[model samples]
Target: MKTAVVLLPGLNRDRDMIAALTKISGTPPVTIWQTETEIADDIDLVVVPGGFSYGDYLRCGAIAARMPVLRALKEKAERGTRVIGVCNGFQILVEAGLLPGALMRNASLKFVCREVKLEVANASTSFTSGYTQGQIIRCPVAHHDGNYVADETTLKSIEDKGQVVFRYAEGTNPNGSMNDIAGIVNEAGNVLGMMPHPENLIEAAHGGDDGRALFAAALEVAA
Candidate 1:
């Protein structure tokens, strides 16, 4: 599959994401700089990795959302190009109006960095096809603004539509997100936004392979 990873200023996880994509996809992913106004054609998936973008000056991902790359991303998403955003990338997706809800400060007012169990809430989408519904997978989450907040009605709508792809399992909600929402997909299922870093857990060296299914599933969909 042809994949592209968008890179923005202040993004510290680009190398990690690049390594993950290379190991999983068997090919180096194209790196799209934030200043670029267009995404490459023939791209099957676009990945927005986690990190403090633009120094998180205003709000995490607030400035990165306005970068030129997102315009191309939005257009590609509308055309059914699969998009996955992790952590701060999730914040950027919400800020760019590609997804619903907002991420607020952690209820504890602290930066949480640790492994958390996530339940596959919806396994039929492109992003979760490799896992069974309700299956728990361990992944690490590191962020302060990972608290997902949305109106009850909106939450209900996404839930009813099966757009809620992943949820914190049991007591694994490290960010105090509303409804324990750890990941969600767009109405069309081509876009996903999640707080956990699956790319950080794809190898045994990272502790477990629970997160491999995510990349494998997306690759299958793109194939």
Candidate 2:
């Protein structure tokens, strides 16, 4: 499968995402700059990696969401292409209106960098199909604004539709997110946004490969 990584200033995790995709798919993903207005239709997956884009000015991912690339990304998503946004990328997706809800500052009001347990709340989505329902996996998170929030109606809608894909498990909630949501997919199930950094824990060298199945499933490759 062909993949592309969106690049924006201050996004430090692009390289990690690139490396993971290369290792998993056996090919380097195309790099899409912030100004690029179009994404090739051949690209099967497009990932917006985690980091403080625009230095988190005016809110996480606020500025990056307005980039020309995001417009094209929205178009791609409308056409049913798969998209994953991690951490700040998750913030950007919400800001850009590609996904629902908002990511607020961590309830602790301090940066958090640690491993958290995530339960596969909805394993039927494209991104979580490799895992089984109710499975718990370890994933690392590094961010200051990982809190996920949504209005009551919106929250209920997503939950009712099984869009909530990952949730903090075993009292591992680090951000006080509503319903302990750690990740979610769009109504169409083609777009996903999450606060965890799965790219960081996708290899044995990183302790274990619990996160590899996600990328493999998204990339249509063997886990």
Among these predicted structures, which one has the highest lDDT?
A: 2
lDDT of each prediction vs. the true structure? 0.91, 0.96
Provide the clash count, candidate 1.
0
lDDT by residue for model 2 (41-63), tens = 89999999999999999999999
Write down the TM-score of every candidate.
Answer: 0.97, 0.99
User: What's the residue-level lDDT of 130 in candidate 1?
Assistant: 93
Error of 2 at 87 (Å): 0.5
Q: Worst ten-residue run, lDDT, model 1?
A: 214-223
In model 1, state the lDDT of residue 135: 97
* Cα lDDT of model 1 by residue, 94-147, tens digit: 999899999999989999999999999999998899999899989999999999
Report the lDDT of model 1 for residue 68: 90
**Positional deviation of 187 in candidate 2, in angstroms?**
0.4
Error of model 2, residue 91, in angstroms? 0.6
Candidate 2 residue-wise lDDT at 168: 95
